[model samples]
Target: MTNLRFREDGSFRVLQMADIQDGPNVLPDTIRLIREAIRKADPDLVVFTGDQIRGYDPAYIDTFLRRRGEEPGARVRAVTEVEAKLRGIKRRARNRVNNRLLAMKSDGSNPDVQQTASTASTTSTLVYSTTSDPQDVPTTLDELMDETRDKVRRTFAGFLGPVIEAEVPFAATYGNHDFQCGILADEQDGIYREFPGCLNPVDSLEPGTFALPIEASDGSGRVAMSVMMVNSGDYAGKPEENDAQYPAYVVNPRGLDLADSDGYGTPSPEAIDWLGAVQSELGERNGDGKPVPAIAFQHIPPQEFYDCLKEVPAWTPNAVEGARTHAGHCYVLNHEICRPGSRLGEAIGCADENVGEVDALREAGGYFALFCGHDHKNAFVGHAHGIDLGYAPTCGFECYGPKSRYRGIRLFEFHESNPAGYVTRMLTWGDLVGRYSSNEVRVWFEDHCVTGAISMRNELRRPQVFAVLSGAMSLGFMAVIRSLVKKR
Candidate 1:
């Protein structure tokens, strides 16, 4: 019932994908890069914006109880070097679950499992065991959240089973390692609404929000865009105080940091006042009386993404040499101007009294932009005055990026008569790894990407017909580069 409006020539395409962090297992090169980002962005919508399920490294139960609370042969050699790295990760998780149940018994696709007796992976039936005294470890955090909640429900069903076997359409948002492994963003959103185009399973919204409706059809009155999801959940919360005024608040004297041992989540102030009451309910009785062009998906980053690094000029001198210096560790005020790796960002990471939820999404007028993915080598886009701030490009080959850029997936081509216009592109996994692929991720999408300009939706939207089609494509690309430089 929510195909999300669109018809007046409504051409919709959205796909973001972020910080994947699939855990306990989901690597077949991250399911061939989520089946090549759903086979080159064949999307009508698919946004993730959060570390999709990586919960369960409660810091080896807080560094094995703060290194076995010291003393006594240095706590039995630090619990025997954390019980020999948990028996070498339960013997390489039982030889990777017996080589994926002997490759599903040589691809007979599990006809009643018999990979030489000892069933385990055909996806994963959670076997990979240990602790029957091979020196044991996990001394509670409820035995490391019941041993990583069955490999985060078999790596979140092997990372949402290739976007529900390519039935695509999808939805997601609670990053900070999706509730840090032990699985519970309402049980990974009830296994993401049993799949098939799950356009938000609505758990009564607002505890991480959701809102689709991008109008162009469905009783099309107009209103052509509004995507929003945002959960941005990180560690704890309860932050308040910092009458915000142009970057100046720092009080995390090591307090209730919700979750860390790698489990990021932060976007509080009740997730920025439920994203300003759903961006002021996208006007016109939520249909199309006008003013409806929005985009927001979260996993942390707000505080005006540090006032959009002093207004983007190719990330403003790397945000002024990244402001100052790292204080608590990662809460950005500095350090991240082209961010390389190691989860950087000192802290403008939304939550501490989130500036009246970005002043009610700048007095809510179909917001503008604010996509996110918790700094995985930041993808840049800044801008604040008329609102827009971005980041999305961390496709999880485990995390930590940058290599001539392209962790891929972040495309958008909206247009249906510009309900606030749209256009964006970035679809790399090095364009599906292997062999030199073409369209090199739209030549690296992000020339301050915020696309959409087919004469801003027809009618030759005047400007002297865009200066006579930009002087006839600048004299037909200078007579085809001067006839190939006069035949060389």
Candidate 2:
């Protein structure tokens, strides 16, 4: 068994932020709230789950191009002119030969023929240039990448400052939105593949399961917290090669493709194998005699619970077009063979036989916590096998419609004494906190209080008594109603 130990004390704080897409006015407000939260929480580590910015919109692409002075229209026009000149030369050569042949056959007496021939040649050349050759469209993916990186850097700097400056060590999992190739091919090729800085620093560290030693409050104890960041996308033969099945597996309702060519999301099989090795190396050791608690962070949630239980429209005839039904969960099968299916389960590659990579981790036997942020909705703590899956809220903006509410983050604190377990709390911000109070300052404080209470209850379990009391009250009310109905 690998021994789990913290370099400092056992207690450490973690902040989970998700889905902060960029907008002019919305960005600043979101950033302010994030900065305030960081200051107030003073978390030891911050984890951004995914979707850092909305980079898919064509308008965003246009705006970025305009900013760089590489507008497509001008480039296209210039290329058009060049092509026209080349075509004009070829047309004039053909016309000269044709006129010579006509003159050779007609006698030298037709002066009108010369004028008509010249006019015909000019019109033909102009028509050929205009209709046959088109100008090349100009799009500098490299420039776009540079702009994106600068924007990301500025945004991150404003929120996180320099890592060294903040003196806070952090780790991140590449979300579906973070990896460019999966979202935009040109953007991925230029920014992510060619440019070194475009890739998130954390991505280069280690692909699989790893342990981070965090200090306890007294600084006398340390806790080795296991973190597994896996690629939920499809897999091809090798991690380096893009999977071919990526375009088929769709996770986002907004029609975002989260898979590479192999259909894996981010970490890839190379990363998955690396993670497996890390877990194997860690074994079962917990710092000081407790079991090591492992947390898996990813942009998307496991398909089994989130994807399977949720309601979706049915397209089949007689299925009640808009009726809701229980669908099996989705999972990644062999990365090489994912195909589109008739059902959602088949669509996500979660066939009946697929156990999923995450399941493999849970089966390996250590206290495991799965934290995700793609769903943008609150899920009651759910347990599958032995793993506890917790879905966190998005920090970027509010999720409107259905269960509409304000945006928030999840705060996780792990203690050294209990290495196998950790406390979790939800921190709401912006309009979410506003729903509770009209005063902005009061709302902030109140939101903090609510979060603090949840955290305390998670750790001590003392406040659960209130939950039990509430349940009992509801039960009593139901019993009285039943008795009164019987008497009547």
Candidate 3:
């Protein structure tokens, strides 16, 4: 474990990275963004907010093994132990896709729908090859499973390499997709702990729940402030069961239907109680019997995000849709309460159920800010009730983000004398690398495959692309309205 302390200058800087969400073959642009952010921030500690790996890849046999009630560790390494089960899962998934295509084809009246169905049917098995050399391809189910496990390890190393090389201590919290590929959160936690600079706790109220203490600058061993890290679990429940609680508003960046995605989860009650306990313990130990100041970090935002949002018309510029109880309406940061420099480009994908994190923190009395990262397109800080709720936009290029220029990291600086008066800023991609990169490439992973594309040099400048798209959409809408008026 790495001990966190204020620098000799009485200052500490933290770099937050969220949703790198890449696979074995990580994108070049993603690496560029991360390296540049690390260099520019020169943070004392790095925090990964989750979704480090794409867990939905078909090659992940561990997910299937776990679903079948089988252990996936080295003890169960025989191919025969899982070959039948893996084949069954694959067959069922393929059948479901083919059945849907058949149903669409049966309705020959809609030629457009039929055409789409046919195309999907033909490309159903076109998985992007993760291996560069044909000889590296696995020839057996056992080999495939081994390759998949290796891929997950490689993915972690690819992203964490920079922090490890920089000798900066780092901690992490898991996101919804992190465990989907077969490695459970606790298992992934083990992998994270193997690194040299990891600060993950060996014991906590829950896995991935721990605290980092910043020691006093005056050579006092007393804690000056505490950075609380909590896990915002995988999913509340299946989509069908919680549809009313978390309405799917927009398809995710990976193009997965929102309706099919599992709902986001919130911190467990024990985790909430753990925060209170930390507050009490710290107060007695160092704060002269007063609660120590703290700033919390989690993977998912609390429901209070809606409380700080003001609804607006769908057509309102820069407005994003609301989720869960506030679905069907568009919202922007309520400037009356939110600080300046806040931006919301997409809906808040909060948990289906309200776990009362905000209320708990408000009542606890010392937490000044809460920052999260599940929603990739939002980067804002809002003051609601008594605490500050904020999001650090995703720094990875593999997922849906605000344009290329806006994708970046968030940095927070704290002073030993006054921890509660800490300051933070967003170091965007445009700040480090130019808004447009000659090397900026389209990077994304699908449920079944991973593919990458590079745009022609300077062909798709971020601003011009969006401007043209907006103008074209407006003209098309106007033409449709005119035709309807003439018919009437």
Candidate 4:
């Protein structure tokens, strides 16, 4: 792996990964590949953008517990409700799969039912089965915590072994999926207590920001590269409730909410403070002196600024109609969060509103870039404020649907020799084990391969190159089987 640097002549490398949900059969090979990728890249820093784990299903646990206790009334009722929802989700998912299969078959695309069956079997054999017994559900939160901790530890150990063993510097941002599915706590007590160093070092600065400084090498010599990690999950909270919109959308169908807090996921005041402190500290030494490049990492994109146009009735007789006629574009928009003209507004606090930490960083003034991964698909959205934003690709075996094509990490090269600019390249995993498959029986009973078809919709914005071979072999095997079948 090649370590990077940041200087006019310096170069630096950063490894970015998204949505590596470690569980069952997915962990081992995934971990191995990730390790290999890290080792191969030898980046100055490793950035895991988000969705490290699939969150816990409270209803599933409730069902098992209820069954074990023979509490057929209240417990059973709650379990039944949750189970029904799960069943519904599963039904919908399966229906979608069936529809896709039929469509593929109709298109003469070889439904590859046998291949799908084999893939399904492999997947089933890999995941840990929680449906062993209802009696296993723990009644206490402590027990739940312990179980989650163990799972996280094991998963982390598998994923981090290479990095740890290689002694690579690493940083991470929490994703809504991770937040919703991983361990939750009213306070920071459990995280600190259980996984002492699991949280980013900058986690103390604010509820959502983390930072790490690195030394990059260049032709001129070694230079410093700093990384800022931010939290961008949407949620509703107390401060937000005081506004006229008291009953805000607090529940994130996708984030961990221990306190059941209301409000879109925004950085906490404490987090903002921490970011300010770091930026201020960095500025004091690095600013007004020379050019220093910094990078930001987060799970979500930042909001775009816009000014609403005010119309005068005297200027336009039909002001209301005129207002409707004119395209109102100048309005603060968070494309990832709020819809245009929607009352929900941007979930991340308004940009004009002083988020002390972020403002402080902005005030410090440095060439900063924010790299993120959440929208699964990769694209670059430029910030009007001169910040360059890059979205990284997923490392998961599967892409979004069967037509979306994007999977890679962004490699950044910064140098003092070229202090004013940096270069980015996308590294894809298309060639590495391009096709994955298992036996026919395995696909039918275990992996359900048909449902795991890869999508090829979005093209990554950055210059990307696939190092791994497309799993054409596995896909071809499926194609062959589909071809042999006669349509009804």
User: Model 1, stretches more than 4 Å misplaced?
Assistant: 1-49, 52-54, 58-130, 133-171, 174-190, 195-211, 216-218, 228-292, 298-345, 348-367, 371-386, 390-488
**What CA root-mean-square deviation does each model show from the true structure?**
23.9, 18.3, 12.0, 17.1
RMSD of 3: 12.0
**lDDT for each of the candidates?**
0.53, 0.43, 0.69, 0.43
Superposition error at 460 for model 2 (Å): 39
Residue 391, model 2, lDDT: 62
Report residue 446 deviation for candidate 1 (angstroms): 35
The best candidate in terms of TM-score: 3
- Mind giving the per-residue lDDT tens digits that candidate 2 earns over 74-130? 112222234435545211112333333233332224545566666764543211122
TM-score of each: 0.29, 0.52, 0.74, 0.55
Misplaced by over 4 Å in model 2 are 1-9, 23-26, 57-139, 161-166, 180-211, 215-223, 234-253, 256-267, 283-291, 306-355, 398-405, 430-433, 436-488
Tens-place lDDT per residue, model 1, 321-372, is 2211222221222233422321222223444434455566767666777778
Question: Residues 404-484, candidate 4, lDDT per residue (tens digit)?
Answer: 112445666555445337666655543333343222232222211221111111111111211112455668888888888
- How many clashes in each structure? 25, 23, 0, 69
Once fitted onto the true fold, the runs of candidate 3 whose alpha carbons sit more than 4 angstroms away are: 58-146, 238-262, 438-488
Using lDDT as the measure, what is the rank order of every candidate, best first?
Answer: 3, 1, 4, 2
lDDT of 3 at 417: 81
The positional error of residue 168 in candidate 1, measured at the CA in angstroms, is: 21
By TM-score rank, best first, the candidates go 3, 4, 2, 1
Task: Give the candidate number with the greatest lDDT.
Answer: 3
How do the residues 78-122 of candidate 3 rate in per-residue lDDT, one tens digit apiece?
232344355452311122233234323332334355556657645
